[model samples]
Target: MRNAGLGSWPHRRARMAPKREAFSYDGVSTTYEEVAVRTTKLARRLEELGVRPGDRVSYLGANHPSFAETMFATHQLGAIFVPLNFRLSPAEINYQLADCGARVLIHAPSHQVEHERAISLDSYEDWLAGGSEEPLDVPVTIDEPALILYTSGTTGRPKGAVLSHANLLWNTFNLMIGVDVTTDDIALVAAPLFHVAALTQTLLPTFIKGGHSVITPRWDVDECLNLIEGYGVTWMFGVSTMYADLAASPRWPTADLSALRVLLCGGASVPDAVIHTYQERGLVFCQGYGLTETAPGATFLEAADSVRKAGSAGTPVFFTDVRLADTGEIEVQGPNVTPGYWNDPVATAAAFTEDGWFRTGDIGRLDDGHLYVVDRLKDMFISGGENVYPAEVENAITDHPDVAEVAVVGVPDERWGEVGRAFVRPRAGAAVDAAGLREFLLPRLAKYKIPVHVEVVTELPRTGSGKVLKPALRRLPLAPAVSPENAPGR
Candidate 1:
């Protein structure tokens, strides 16, 4: 309660609840007392490496107890913590490090990253074991950049979002009300912890509330389901696709999921059907909407409203402001919003409005104070001068019984300038074809919004957070351009 600095939480909790389990990973569990002690030791070791305040300390690894320890250690010395996405290729990972000017790099045992400043997990512990287990008293304010998370960069080069201690603390306040966190809550962090959604939205809040967190190195449907039953995980966050896969699990029907209170989802809008799948099992799907720049916790749909107001991202949380620009782009202004991108003044200027509103780049509409996301502004295309949002078209296409998952992208057209192409992934045992899907969408969507081409595929390329990789999908070769005029029965 003294301050919401990342380094202070474990120390405070250790005094209040020393024996309480903080985070459980693989087969090992760390108590609040243990976490505070471990982070203190690591902080001293980092100082021995000449890490100073304002320097960047980057961590690249899977979900391990050491990730949290590294975060606390970096912030304790007022150094910036940079968590690299393990899913990124070595080149991409190296690009982020060079861009941030990281001085120290830490990786998991399994990875063999050959950087002059890099240290493996074993070496990290060896250093920690030898260092003094005393807290470092460095000058740190709430406004200091505590963490830097590089964006996925679906469009251009990746930019590092500079999240300050204040930003993260405010995000936890939003999450506490968003998910109703409590001391008894045990969150199963199945998603990649490097992402803001999983770390700030779930794990950080749980830690602050003196609750327990269970980590999975990677998401395996079976392992996640087992943890929910085995550990009695009360809350967890994942994307819509993860939920879809969970519902499709063979043990889903029989799994004892009564212990779960909230099943949080974001990254992309949850399909209406996917929401129903969890609802049928007595689970609440709290779909959220936000960006990494906003410390990633903004709006969250309530459990009760999940069904009645199916596709809405709900209202803004406490201390957050969500408004629309003249162009209908969602603009946010709040303490949770990052001060700016790391070392990029030009990009930072363009990210905000003249009056300081952070441009979210996402297009959405507010209905009765609730937010309904349309699609990304960049993803929207013009067909014969009419605007087409792929999400609107994709929703109609998903109504077909056979279509399981779908990604709609705008392809170049000679007649309309730009037209939509449907990439369909059929349900497990169902069959799908182009003409049939087009006919199914005709009545549900406007004729102009109807896709000119529909190609059935086994799967759509997706990000670690479950967003469809539209940039990658656009690079794929289509079978043949099937115009509306070429409709099978036309």
Candidate 2:
């Protein structure tokens, strides 16, 4: 196989296994050769449409085989690929498309009505139907931008992080150094391609190894389990919430999960219980941490340390540097670090330090070289002059047997300035109330760290990648604050 480099993945795959199955979805299979051929044609079609080097080609769709094809095609033309989160509102999507100045927008047939303002690649299927099966020769520099993935932007408008071809290529190599993947391996890609976690961490790595990718349009627990069992899937990656749901499902133990080898969980703090549950089932579960700015992967929990370093995001991946500011913010610098936010120099300058470290905005600490994420610096709050980190509080609450999921936020309080409030989702078939949960947390957390108000909810708002939308929680109404006379320890 040839060396890994920018615009070299498809070429490498074609040489490694031209006729081998590269992707499968809904009973449709595309070989490495076919993918290469289609992508080449798509690139020509894009060029005919006036897409030039540095132009952005945006895509809004669920996980599908075409999504991968479009990504490779965009790279084939030296065009930037911008993937929009399907979960975002139309207005939010419009803002991103306009912000990126995308010349062409490719979307799923289902989203055609919602995104009709731009040209659709699906509509031009016939144009791409027949073209040169030969590969389109395009030159790409290592420093050239390959993709633009928007941050979740829980606090403000999302920023477009420009990931260079070298950024992604090196990050994939970093992942391969840690995780052993082979051509015989089959990866289950249930997460959305819009996020770097799914794109760079899972899909790109699988492609680099000449492995097969099994894509699911969306996350349906039963469907995911069925596909894993039927396709003999060997690897999978998902958010902590997805892992918790799969572990808690009644069908999990009975399903043929024996084929599954590695399960990666990230995007949020993972509960210890979820890790233990998967361990009991003989599945190896590892935690990973990264941001869009870092090409999505900076650290990974090694299999040897999976249990010993439970709840930790582990050490930085190869070629990545991690440091903590005096204020406790985690700063990262490495090849995988993004060049900058596209067309937003002011925000881009603000995201980095004078020394060139990218401010992750996440507060964490390193213990003996292992990274432990505490909470987002923006999520930290002050109540009555006391500092509180929500992750610390949420961890304590989720440890409770009855609590299935929990999110902590600061709510307005007249006397204390701001107080902690928790929104909890109880375990299935478990009876839990505010008082019981509060009592359960009292001994586990400090007085100020414990939530004063608890609300039972069916579900919590989350981003496409399953991260808790704390900003949405902040907008929700909080219960009336307790009077000074009745407040605890007042």
Clashes of each: 0, 0
TM-score of each: 0.79, 0.77
Candidate 2 per-residue lDDT, tens place, 1-490, comes to 2222344567668877899889999988889988877888887777777888889989888888878887888887788999987655565577788889888888876665344335555665686786566656666777888898876343345678899989998898888887888888999998778878888888999998889999998878899999999999999888765676687788987999988889987777667887888889888888988887898788889888887888889899988989899999999999999989888898889899999999988899899799998767677665543446676677767888988988989876644546788898999998777767767765554465567777888899999999999999999877664333323221
Please give the TM-score that candidate 2 achieves against the real structure.
0.77
- Over 4 Å off, model 2: 1-6, 113-124, 152-155, 380-490
Please give the CA lDDT of all the candidate structures.
0.82, 0.79
Model 2 clash pairs are none
Which ranges in model 1 have alpha carbons more than 4 Å from their true place? 1-4, 153-155, 380-490
